[model samples]
Target: MIFSRITEVLTHVGVITLLILLAVTLVYYPEFRLVVFLTFIMVITLTVYISRRAARKPPKLFDVIADEVRRGSILFEVDDDEVSRLLEKDFTLYEEFRKQSYKALLESVIIVPIFLWYFIYFYLILPRFVITDLNLRLIAYIIGFVVPYILYLASELVFRVKTLTYVLRGYEVYDRGIVSSSQYIVIKFPLSKDYLVREYSNRKCVELSRKHGRYTVRFLLYTKNTPKLTETLSNYGKAEVISS
Candidate 1:
């Protein structure tokens, strides 16, 4: 905990120092304003990418690995129907995991081409104001807009789809708690009073929650052997089971 706090503090200090340097350069060196701005945006984007990647990295082997060696007894694998029921029951909680609706599909279809056109229009006009030579202006436009747009697209494709798939398809159950996947990470929740459990009417399914910082992480697990699953959880973690 102390190490984590120190690292967080250092991260903040570094970012603040970088910003101050950028500000100083922009104010004192007008000739390099464009370069400074580009550097600023690149740094910001790279920081975001690194932070997100770190957040999505998996935990320790014991917590996240799917190995046969010391795999602790397999409790259950969450199935499609179970996932569907959970989504149907508490969609607001897991809306991002749901399949894309027609409205969203339509919006994407409409917005992407329009965004491209907008970028193209600006790319054509903005450079003329700054650069006198046609070739140099085109090169500047490529550097400023085209590269960033491609990077944006690549990041979206790499991160978002994997995250969506993990949320929708990856869940595992063990004796103590549940293990679920997110983006490129696997999270383990230990069963305890601290974790909330909701049992549906038939005892075939359960929803569990753990508080992580300010956010609540929840998982739904289903099993054919409902009694055994409940008993195992109760015995291992003494979880308070709430009926829903």
Candidate 2:
């Protein structure tokens, strides 16, 4: 229940911070602050819903990988009841995927707008302010503009290079308790994201089951996760890997 507990803590913190901000706004900018706060609340709700839905249906990349890993006939072709069993244990995995997708999508969508706003505010608005109030440092303005752009680019790169799906199971995403040496390798979904090279198109993937004593990934350099790879290796037991 760590996830539920942490979720509660974060929700509490966010709510409290929002309340404080609202109180400050009421005191400092009573004219239009309430309207802005209402807009913020609406936007936040919409974003959370859209993100949760998108997480349920990741772009083709994760779709392909999840399909392969979840529906693969080799290990996944289980009885209907057994399939349900696999889905037991946790709902946090799905939530984790949803949160990451939301963050990445938000980053992608915000980059351009953020850049444009910065250019307009600093170059047009700030200079006008400087003309009226002589305390504006030109050097500081230049640094601020450059720093934000650099940060935006870096964030974009990080998102592009990061994993589409991340999972934390039992106690941790990498938790390896006495789950019994699974006949089908119950890899907790996120068991090996740092080194997995699965694709995202909900494509079919081959599973290992001592079938000829080998396991493998059929593609190379597909999606981002921590440790990126360009190809599958001859041995997967020793090397880390996972599907979306």
Candidate 3:
């Protein structure tokens, strides 16, 4: 397992390293950069395909839940809509949480500088680097701008699709447990009385505590109907609301 994970990490790093190298090379050799641009597209397409395949693979937690379900141990199941709603709520809360973090500030610092560098290098320096006809240089400039933007849009699309797939999975609240998964489960745990239900960013979240671990599951954003879900969970176990 460790070896496979290492291999996957290396594969991703290698792809990124190659792309960076190609981008740098484009600065010096703008003539044949179109070919490099096409190669970049191909690489990105393959990466997205591989990522989607990996996403479909069942997580280890699913195996444990399958065994339990086979033994008729599951008591109740939550619909996919409820799971998705909760996940969306959590995503919003997480975004708000992230915005307040030092890491977010650091990311902005790093990303903004890199973007500025790319714009200056490609738009100004790259055109000057071109030792060819004005028309060809114009084409190079267009390719330089379009390729990166296309890559960025494609990457965002992949991320959104992956997140959507994850949250759309049906969840099961077993006789004594719950499994979090859409297609492949990643978490399964027994319910604990020490759990807390709280509101954060106008969303409901339940923090489940077990003998040796804790997991927090988020629910829908606060609305007129939010109390219904909270009331249902409260009926099953101890629940308390605290500040975000």
Candidate 4:
């Protein structure tokens, strides 16, 4: 009974609470710190086990959507295979975006801890430098921090550009939304929402607006991919042909 209650409590406690509990235990209950740490590990392991079990038991979101469409409960004209393909494409794009975002974030922050260590190391070793003057040692210390910081800034800019470029080209279209690709900008237009579509001679553009048109996003699709995408979106939206 006690273990079950503990499990229930820990399951309801959020990540912040868990962190706070660990910190408090480390500071105030040194004798029981090892036990508390083991408990935390067990909680994480249980959570992972539960998550994997749930994942394995699913009719999955895509499968449900496809089933609903097949039964004519959802009025989409797409077949189950098309629905599956589109959902898979969206999932793949989302996963790619998620991974690239994690990489960019990791790259941006990895330098921080390393340079923090450098700052401390340089400050501690100030006296051992050949320049014995206090002023020179101070300058050296500041330089050590400033140079790495500048390099970090440059790396952050580069990663930001790379991430942006990756999203701005190779645009993708599906039943729910369009995925823009390339180097500068990425836009997603959901067909379920109110949107505007404009077609040019060689390309097509999708515009989605929200908050009474207070915010808008537009993306272009090349001519080659327009037909299938237009067919998919026709039931939800219409396109306007633009004169040259």
Candidate 5:
């Protein structure tokens, strides 16, 4: 009993000491990191509080994935009204939206810090280094711009699960399956159509794949004509389950 109490007291003391040190650092240097740290804590606290406040949230996942896949997987076409109906026809829409929101949160959490780091290095510290090192200025600027670009790309690539292209205009999801997935990549789109295209930007046929473990999704963006859209595939997602 005495040992347990001592251990508990020590743990509390250690945590308090660490927090005090962190507060001191923040007070000394009110930098981006400190602000980001505080922001992250607020977000985490909000997420936990909101999640805990609600109970019996219902089975909303399967419905969403199913509806989105079905709506977006069609090869033919759909009108705006029909699309609305499809989206609202079932409970899946709500769940799919939740899924999207979750994806957004994951992205936001990741991006906030990377952006802070960029601000610190480029806007804050890099100038000091470059002022003394004439040879390093060009490289520094290049690296500064490129590093953030890379981080932005990486964050998007990592968290782009809902990155779907409005291919086939109004076509719907006939089927879906896991073509492939990974940390930096994920491809998921309608399996019914052979090709999905985004015409507004350019003409390209992009194969879609959901990201691994629900982090992000990736679709191969390419261009092709309607005649080539005849090809088809079986089984969109692995172990395809019927959702609400």
Candidate 6:
């Protein structure tokens, strides 16, 4: 865990350093800005493309659940039979959710905007601004402000959609508790804790209280066996069904 945190910190530092260098180059060496800009765009585009492609291919279900169990520090014993049963029931559904989530993230939030910014700035705005026409320069400035604002809104909308989809469909029940995944984020709520299980309409949700506060979370997919699941959860804490 320490190594992982250190690696994350180093990665952030590297990215910030690169951004500062790129900015300095743009300011002091205008002649090379186009080359640098194109290179950066190409790198981002390729990285996003590769990442999306890789995310579409999920690992074996047993491996995924095993990794999560270890990461969550789950104390209850889980054998191969239990793991296989869980996988047998939810593997296909989990795969489908993952694909949709990652696709939404890549196209709506990452790759499309990179290409859009490249086209808008490099091909359109930059060339016009270079001519030094007052009216055209004003238009360029307006576009510079507006485009990113619009992209920000779009990105947020897509992020919310992806987040909701992930939260609703992606969770697994183990002997200890429930494990959920959202893209790279994983959260586990052990049944031994202060928790509540509630059902509304077709959805079943869990609320876990931590040092910070209570978090009410809904599962990503609906199951017909919600009553059974709720009964199992009640063994750990308060569990009930609520009217819609």
The candidate that achieves the highest lDDT relative to the unseen native structure: 1
After superposing candidate 1, which stretches have Cα over 4 Å from the reference? 58-96, 99-193, 212-219, 224-228, 235-237
Clashes of 4: 7
Give the Cα lDDT of each candidate: 0.52, 0.38, 0.49, 0.43, 0.41, 0.46
What TM value does model 1 have?
0.48
Candidate 3 versus the native: TM-score?
0.38
Residues 137-241, model 2: lDDT tens digits: 433443433455446445644554233322211110112210112222233333243434433323222122111111121221112222322122213223443
**Which runs in model 2 stand beyond 4 Å of their true positions?**
1-85, 129-145, 157-161, 164-244
What 10-residue stretch in candidate 4 is worst by lDDT?
58-67
> What order do you get sorting by lDDT, best first?
1, 3, 6, 4, 5, 2
lDDT of 3 by residue, 62-93 (tens): 33654463343554556766656666656664
- lDDT for 85 in candidate 3 is 62
- Candidate 6 displacement at residue 177 in angstroms: 7.3
Per residue, candidate 5 scores C-alpha lDDT tens digits across 35-60 of: 74565356434543433222112212
Q: TM-score winner among the candidates? A: 1
- Which residue pairs clash in candidate 3? 169-182
For model 6, the superposed segments whose C-alpha errors exceed 4 Å read 1-17, 30-34, 46-110, 130-190, 200-229, 235-244
List the candidates' TM-scores in order: 0.48, 0.30, 0.38, 0.33, 0.29, 0.43
Deviating ranges (above 4 Å) for candidate 4: 1-84, 89-99, 116-120, 123-125, 161-244
Could you tally the backbone clashes for each prediction?
0, 13, 1, 7, 27, 5
Error of 3 at 74 (Å): 9.0
Cα RMSD of predicted structure 1: 9.5
